[model samples]
Target chain A: MATVRAALVQEASAQFTSRQPLVLVVDDDPDVRASLQDMFESVSLETAVFESTAEMLQHGIPDRPCCLVLDLRLPGTGGLEFQAQLREMNQFVPIVFITGHADVATSVRAMKAGAIDFLPKPFRQQELLDVVSHALRTEGEKHRDGGERNTVRRLGESLTPRETDVLRGVARGLLNKQIAYELGITEITVKMHRSSAGRKLKSISVADMLRKIDLLGI
Target chain B: MATVRAALVQEASAQFTSRQPLVLVVDDDPDVRASLQDMFESVSLETAVFESTAEMLQHGIPDRPCCLVLDLRLPGTGGLEFQAQLREMNQFVPIVFITGHADVATSVRAMKAGAIDFLPKPFRQQELLDVVSHALRTEGEKHRDGGERNTVRRLGESLTPRETDVLRGVARGLLNKQIAYELGITEITVKMHRSSAGRKLKSISVADMLRKIDLLGI
Candidate 1:
């Protein structure tokens, strides 16, 4: 009985941990939000909808691969203002804007602010679907790339400060002599740090070591 | 009949003129090019292979969605220089680099120069295929976007010089009075220019006109 219960718990936990990719729809109109939700659902995509920025903010961001479908003319904190807020918080989630009243100036600001795409309302359903998919894929890449950098950073934590300096030099395409001179260390010492860093990071070649260090922001 | 003969000629011309999407593989290694060609063929994508940049250059760019799969360590010109050459010629084709010897410095330079993904040799076949598809999609978007910008530019040419100045001011989110003051013109003149610009572009709303002007580089 205990074993069966544990198996059931494990299955439930697995389902809970593995999230479905999502699209967050933020629009003031009920019809717009509902239509968007249904459209995403037709493609087997999950979505959460909000009528205002305040409500959307309360929901927080999900960890799964997701993109925002923001209506430009939202109540209170307009789409551009909310986008600025997201940027100030250093969140780089992909966003697609939908507006009934499309302006060149506002759209340019939205694009400059890093929006994925802008859809003028009465837009074809297929166009929105295409942009949604593109935004999700772009967000997925950012997440994966971020995770990769984190792994590289973890590996970097094992390096000594001297080893870190040596790794940076190599990553910059500097020779051991240049690194040694820059650090006021002997060439032999620089070599030792490079080797030590390599071994600690399990890197097999200068190229591989440099790749990791660069990813780690060395 | 004349119609039947015309139809036959039209079909033949269509077959010759309608080109398929292509991946251009440029590498010094004959084997690398061959393998890449086979991989693309497996996915029903077309490929053209070359042993050097000089040979690749001779063919010129195709008027279709395409990307270059370049080897970083070519015998002459090398990948980076060749990328520079393409840029100098006002070509912005997407490039994906593959190298057996990927060092941090060269890979970084390759990325900074806008090479897509840098795959080390011994990468999975699926990885290459995925990246190739991504590069093709990216190139496809660039072409589409360029066409969109061109259309916007053509629309912009309809505006009179004063209208163009007023469009710029409004695109900057400046009020009519502010634009008038800045341009040393009366508020009424600024309004007149804005209205004339709107009428010429057939823009129905402020947002719509602003979007076009922004794309037109106002």
Candidate 2:
């Protein structure tokens, strides 16, 4: 397995560049890791091969847009346990698991743990590529949403309770008059709150503020 | 299989009086279909089970909001062929596949054909329920978008090509001045196009028009 990891990294160094999305490949079997690296690199994705879960954690994961192609049978920590650890660390990067011993119980558990897809061993290159692409796209969307939500949270952290209420109403697509009526305030007061909230958030338009709120899902 | 179909229909009939979402379970195995019907019914979803592809096609899928839990190893047409047929008919209903022999190639192929998820045989009841819920939610979103798009298309069909172009630009988050600059037209002409397009689409504001356009992904 160690040989497999070294060989995969060597091969990936020759084939993939930093421009492509990085994929971490974790499997105990050397052959499996090498094959996966070859397959993903063929699609122009950077691949990092790890022989075990310990190695993966020790090597440290990159903060770039990436995903995992993990094998269920690992040496140190099993795939399912590793998945739990990753979730505990709040690493929501998408994962696609490959397993030789296919079973309903394991697959179901994996899906419930937020796996993007699970493939049995001896998969075709196209099959792997398609799943990887889907995982990458899903991760990208999620990462973008996370960034927007962070921005929204930072912007909203300083708002007063009343102003936050007004912001929620605005985010829900309420008009000024409607918000004023709902809040039992005059339209002029509602306008004042809106302007103040906008200034505090550094947003120029209601739409931009709403977009941020939408990202926050509030 | 026939017994499963009967049980599913009975379950569906019982639930149809309420507003629960319906699910169509297509499989050749009686036990599999029966299990799925029980699982779905437990979660307050209607289930209609069929023994074969021909039976499903003969019954004619309902226009109501629904999804399919298809079996990969069907008697005649099989899962992949049925999926292709559904795609050919332009049906975008989400599917969750059940397979006795799960493999990477088969799962990937099903996903590419728009399956929301796949579970191997002997799956947990909660597993099926979770995937079904996700699939229904996704299909619901798509249906809502499709309804909005249909209304927009009906209205946009009456517009001239230039008006449609301006409408698209508005949907793409462009201002009238920016659209005019991009199209090499006067802002007045752009406003005229926007107003005409909005009136034709029965929209009151640029925001509504933009929402419709976003729903249509144009």
Candidate 3:
């Protein structure tokens, strides 16, 4: 009984330690990475620092619940391009972009690409920590609920070509009769397609369906 | 027919005139407000400048779609508090916060509170314009969407007590069986509640549901 109790305690401890979210810090500057690592650690997080985006990609990101702390300027592929690549790969980990100047155009573009937060250079330690904490917590929650998310994404992708056409028309605020006229189908047929598409996307309302389509940017 | 044609011409002219979105500039400093008004008008946007929040609020906001250009420090209910009030009143017009000092803590707090962007004192003209343009465009899109986002927010707010409990547990990474046991409900019932909450929130997946919850900090 004592041995069994000891084993249970060990298992609980392992689970607790494993639950600490990991953060990947990718910046060319060693000092920045070190400081961020220290800050994240102080908050009971585990962090890995990479000097370049190349180094980060080479190491192959771990499957552990994680987020990327990325610098806006990097060697080779630049930050913006890297972000574009991540989006193309459907890697939706929350990103906190760090930059020297908060250029308005660049910031707008980054936000449109789904970056969670942006911090200008010479930012306060607490500001960085706060954003990082928020980002990691967000990523951790995503990891926890990834199963349902992937299922939805997959279901959205599996939509038939005709259903997708119907969806785009719906998103344009087309009425059911209008969609049927455009698609050369009966109104009843339009309703059937719409219902099927919504079921696959796990969406119940037309507005919800439109929002999911927007999120996928399709 | 002639009168109708003349009225149509006048309406077309008004549409052209209203192409440039109006901006409400709120700052206590006359020079700053005037300078901003001049700058924005040069870019063809309409500007209404005020020296205080009270003045702007009293004058009543513009009837057309608009965003606020706010100074962090004001006479009475300051920028931060005004922002809080705006959110409480569910007036989600985008805000661009300007400050004379580079207060990181305040800036982060403002960003977390949904300020579209933050600009420090001595910002370049282009920087200010860039942020304003983005804010205006975002606000215009929201208006054009006919308040679809408000529907999402309202649905998110309507989660039942049991659903909220299940959502928190799901965010914390509990499996369905685990949540069922924790809530003392059948697993089928847990599934029903989870699906219902997700539907109500217009979330296609658990991750999306969690993201909405995190955004609302519920």
Candidate 4:
């Protein structure tokens, strides 16, 4: 557990330099940590090996594609408990668990809790890497570049409530005439608001406005 | 294989009746197919097992979240060959392989080719299920309701190229003046185009147009 903390810093530093899927290994065994690190690194994947969940928490979750490789048993908060805590905190990183002893109960509980994969000690290197690869690829689809979403959110915020209503209707493929009729407003009013919204959003044409809005998911 | 194919048809019918993730198992063994189908169905996942990739192809790819469980050695096209063929045909599905006797070379090759998990026969049911769970969860993110994307595409096709350029600039957060200058057009012309495009798209306001476009991903 102690040696895991020491290696944690090195893993964090290496992770910042590359845009690869991250594997966060939390194990008490220094040898297991080292072996997992080497295996992941061999395939050009980055890893952050921690001895304890607390130590891993100090650095916070890395803001990139990553998966957790947890040992079933730990010093303070065991793998299962930490997993539950993460869920409570609304953190959704995929987790793969490893343990020396195997039990049907532990495996079933882990899977029910959404653990990605569980392996007994002395697991095959290729087998573990393959599971990690799948985890990362799956998580990749969800790591939607947080910064971009924020900017889009801010842009949408500039719209008036009435404008937003029209926007939603239009985005959902409703005709302006239909939107106005449904909202008990004149089509002319809808056109005027649409024009104003484009001006505020800095769009130059209808296509441009729609394209921008679609991308922003406004 | 014959029994597997029979079960596959049943699985396909069940999958069509619901939105569960499809686990396509390509194995030559009947016992393997029946066991895998029961395993997946128990957890509410749909299984489409085939004795060979060719037989699997006959069913075509199901239109839903899916992962492939491949047995490395098979008649006609082997697991690896079918994997490559799928790639050539532009199909990308998460794959898990099962083999009676495993070796380092084959495991490495399979993982490198993007197989999700590799298991030796007599694998724990939990292990296979966990891997399948990970693959399915990951694929879920990439599945964005195909029908919606199609509708969006059709709406986008209605826009003119010039309108699309304007929309792209707007989506990128550019100002009308900036877009006009970038496109060598006057700001007034940009406004007129935007307004007309809005009318053509049936969006009453600029915000409406932008919203519609965003949904269409133009």
Best by lDDT: 1
For candidate 4, give the docking quality class from DockQ: incorrect
RMSD values, in order shown: 30.3, 10.5, 12.3, 11.1
| lDDT for each residue of candidate 3 in B55-126, tens digit (9 for 90 to 100) | 888987554568799999999989999999988877877898888865554675677678777787887989
Residue range with the least summed lDDT across 10 consecutive positions in model 4 chain B = B144-153
C-alpha TM-scores of all predictions: 0.45, 0.63, 0.56, 0.51
Q: Write the per-residue lDDT of candidate 4 for residues B150-211, one digit (tens) a residue.
A: 44455566678998888777666577898899999999888787766666667655555555
For candidate 2, the docking band is incorrect
lDDT tens per residue, model 1, B127-185: 87887898787666666666666556656776888888888887766789989999999
Regarding DockQ, does 1 or 3 come out ahead?
3
DockQ for every model comes to: 0.01, 0.15, 0.06, 0.07
Stretches > 4 Å off in candidate 1: A1-20, A173-178, A186-188, B1-218
Q: How badly does each model clash, as a count of residue pairs?
A: 6, 0, 0, 15
In Å, residue A18's CA in model 1 sits off its true spot by: 10
1 against 3, candidate with superior lDDT: 1
TM-score of chain B of each: 0.73, 0.67, 0.59, 0.74
Cα-based lDDT for every prediction: 0.79, 0.77, 0.77, 0.78
Q: Residue-wise lDDT of candidate 2 within A162-204, one digit each (tens)?
A: 8877877776557788889999998888889888988887876
| Ten-residue region with minimum lDDT total, candidate 4 chain A | A10-19
Kindly list the interface RMSD, in angstroms, of each predicted candidate in the order they appear.
Answer: 28.9, 4.9, 12.0, 7.8
